[model samples]
Target: MRTIAALELADCRRIAAAAEAMAAQHQASVSLAICDGGGHPLLVVRLDGASPSSTAVAMAKARMAALNGKPTADQEAAINGPRPALLQLAGVFKEGAVAMGGGLPLLHSDTCIGGVGISGMTPELDGAIAAAAAAALQGQPG
Candidate 1:
């Protein structure tokens, strides 16, 4: 059998903190989510001034990143571009893969271990936060 790394609580906390820091730096209010390899939530936070709907959207983006091992922006591009048909597949997911920016997978040794997602402000700001959070995983133990 092969062994794969998984995210621990500390990793989740670290990612969330990084996301929050990025948002704070930008003076953006957003919701953040961290999830395990299986798309299970580890931590979720909705910052002040964020829309309540953003909380659910953040979680959905995180789940999609974790399960797909891809950034949600790519998914968004696909649906918005030549592959609008992809939306049909999204409908069947337990939480539809949020086809938007602001989600990234946590990779260790090139393998996805989890994901981080952010939402509320502009997609650019949210994606920046998610990128910062995913970067926090660098140098962390498996």
Candidate 2:
């Protein structure tokens, strides 16, 4: 078996911080979540005024990104493409996976180490927050 890099507490902190900053910049009340490569949650934050449901949505987005190694928006596009029926059938096998625009995989050395998810605002803003968090991971050691 081969070993893979994993996210540490510091990494989680950085992701949360960046996501929070993004939310603040956008004036959005949002929820952010981070998950391990295996799709296990590591950290979750709900900004002031964010709805309770945002937390669950954030977690699901993070899991989708980590497990699929791609942005949730891309997954959304795939699921809505011409062959959507086939994609939906496949999605049935990947329970809890969602097609949304607020999740991004955390990459280290071109390998997915974790993921970040954001919710509460529009899908565009949520995706921006998640992207900021994922970008913050760059240049940091795994």
Candidate 3:
């Protein structure tokens, strides 16, 4: 049976707010996306000047990490292996998953309960912003 575990509106807002704050500090527009534990999108936000392409890129990268229950950096690092299908089918390369940084998995306890992705900036900055957003929602109620 399929289960649903989407993020609440309040949580989504909190994540976006964190991302916006970081983006403002960096003087960069960004696309942010949050996905549930199951890698389904719960919310997506794109700043006005953010690149249109970053929206999809952010979501895909976040979902990839969330689905695997690991940081996207690790996933990308292991992309090339005996089975190319995982990376190929995932379209991970196109999503910028293998880049040095940009995607991070969100966690609750030891389980990865979600992921936050930010794009439209340097990969380091993207990862930083996403991490900041997740940190913001760390102790709050859903």
Q: What is the C-alpha lDDT of each candidate?
A: 0.86, 0.85, 0.75
Residues 44-77 of candidate 3: C-alpha lDDT, one tens digit per residue: 8899899999998888778776776676665556
Once model 1 is optimally superposed onto the true structure by TM-score, how far is the C-alpha of residue 74 displaced, in angstroms?
A: 1.1
Each candidate's clash count: 0, 0, 0
Error of 1 at 7 (Å): 0.5
lDDT of 2 by residue, 1-142 (tens): 9788899999899889888987888899999999998889899999999999999899988988888798988888877785465355326535565668999999988899888889898889999888888878884322
Model 2 alpha-carbon miss at residue 104, Å: 0.5
Relative to the true structure, candidate 2 has a C-alpha RMSD (angstroms) of 2.8
Q: Score candidate 3 by lDDT.
A: 0.75
TM-score for every candidate vs. truth? 0.92, 0.89, 0.79
Task: State candidate 1's TM-score.
Answer: 0.92
The 10-residue segment of model 2 with minimum total lDDT is 86-95
Instruction: Give the alpha carbon lDDT tens digit for every residue of 98-135 in model 1.
Output: 76899899999999988888999888888989998998
Ranking by lDDT: 1, 2, 3
